[model samples]
Target: MECLLGLLKVKVVRGLNLAICDPLSHSSDPYVVIHLGQQKVKSSIKYKTINPEWNEELTLSITNMMLPVKIDVFDHDTFTKDDSMGDAEFCILDFVEVAKKDLNGLPDGTVMKTLHPDKDNCLAAESHIKWKDGKVTQDIFLKLRNTETGELVLHLEWVSIPGITH
Candidate 1:
């Protein structure tokens, strides 16, 4: 059985300059789906927009920190199947490591670490894991891979379960 590590709250904030999936309309209805092992969560569909503000919060029960959380953006369709917009992923290990340390003296908005986008990872730009509002959190900007044009902004927070034990 997989051991339950803790809960992670991922906030799908918005999309930026998404692809034009719909030809006639010049816009597309987009939604986000998050996959972490067997747990899959989806955000509500935002219609007729390249830049959509979802402000959706999804919680995932993390079993392994090494496993990456996959994110996919899709264009919703009423008749045919939804078209794939793009995909991105992020790991929680580094974020969790910083959260385990003593960050009492750090000022608000202090960046603990900066993760650069590379060929292996889907980060569009420099992602900063910051200490904000008395918690370990991250704001990520991902350039959608395998697509012509698209971007996503996400916020992540790790919550420790106090009574969880092996």
Candidate 2:
């Protein structure tokens, strides 16, 4: 059985009002690391600030849509290990559903959809039929928490290729 591959584009935009784990210290040096199975990518570290702008883009090849992607925020430490700030997880299939609702075809005949962020910081989009080479773009605000408090701003685009099935 030949499985189809999908292209997942993840943009680590920025951090907003992140929690300061080291309150007695000056500030926190924060960075983000995203993982999907064995594939992992890290963003640039922002030194001494609760708010950091990464503006980095990462691409991952996906064979299964059901797998969840994890995004973890950490504070860089020199002597000690990096401290975990917070993390969030999302599935690619959710965006696929959104893409299938609102459909737009490009000049090259590539179908695309746009998912907008809601007032409550939730993400939702429309989709349509014709799954060949379909694309979905979404801007989402993810709240990260694990015994701490923080939020991560991310932009994602999921592209599906035709002629392949998993």
The candidate that wins on TM-score is: 1
lDDT of each: 0.89, 0.71
In model 2, how many backbone clashes occur? 8
Give the alpha carbon lDDT tens digit for every residue of 1-166 in model 2: 4254677888999888887967777578999988987789888899989988889998887766778888888999889999888877766776656543535554433434443444532232332222343455666677775635667777777666665433
TM-score to native of every candidate shown: 0.92, 0.73
Residue 44, candidate 1: C-alpha displacement in angstroms: 0.2
Q: Clashing residue pairs, candidate 2?
A: 99-127, 100-127, 100-128, 101-126, 101-127, 101-128, 102-126, 102-127
Tens-digit per-residue lDDT, 47-159, candidate 1: 99999999999999988888899999999999999999999888788887786677878999999999998888888888888889888899888889878999999999877
lDDT of 2: 0.71
Query: What local lDDT score does residue 81 receive in model 2, on the 0 to 100 scale?
Result: 94
Q: Model 1, stretches more than 4 Å misplaced?
A: 164-166
Q: How many residue pairs clash in each candidate?
A: 0, 8
Candidate 1 similarity to native, TM-score: 0.92
| Residue 57 in candidate 2, Cα distance off native in Å | 0.3
Indicate the residue-level lDDT of 38 in model 1: 86
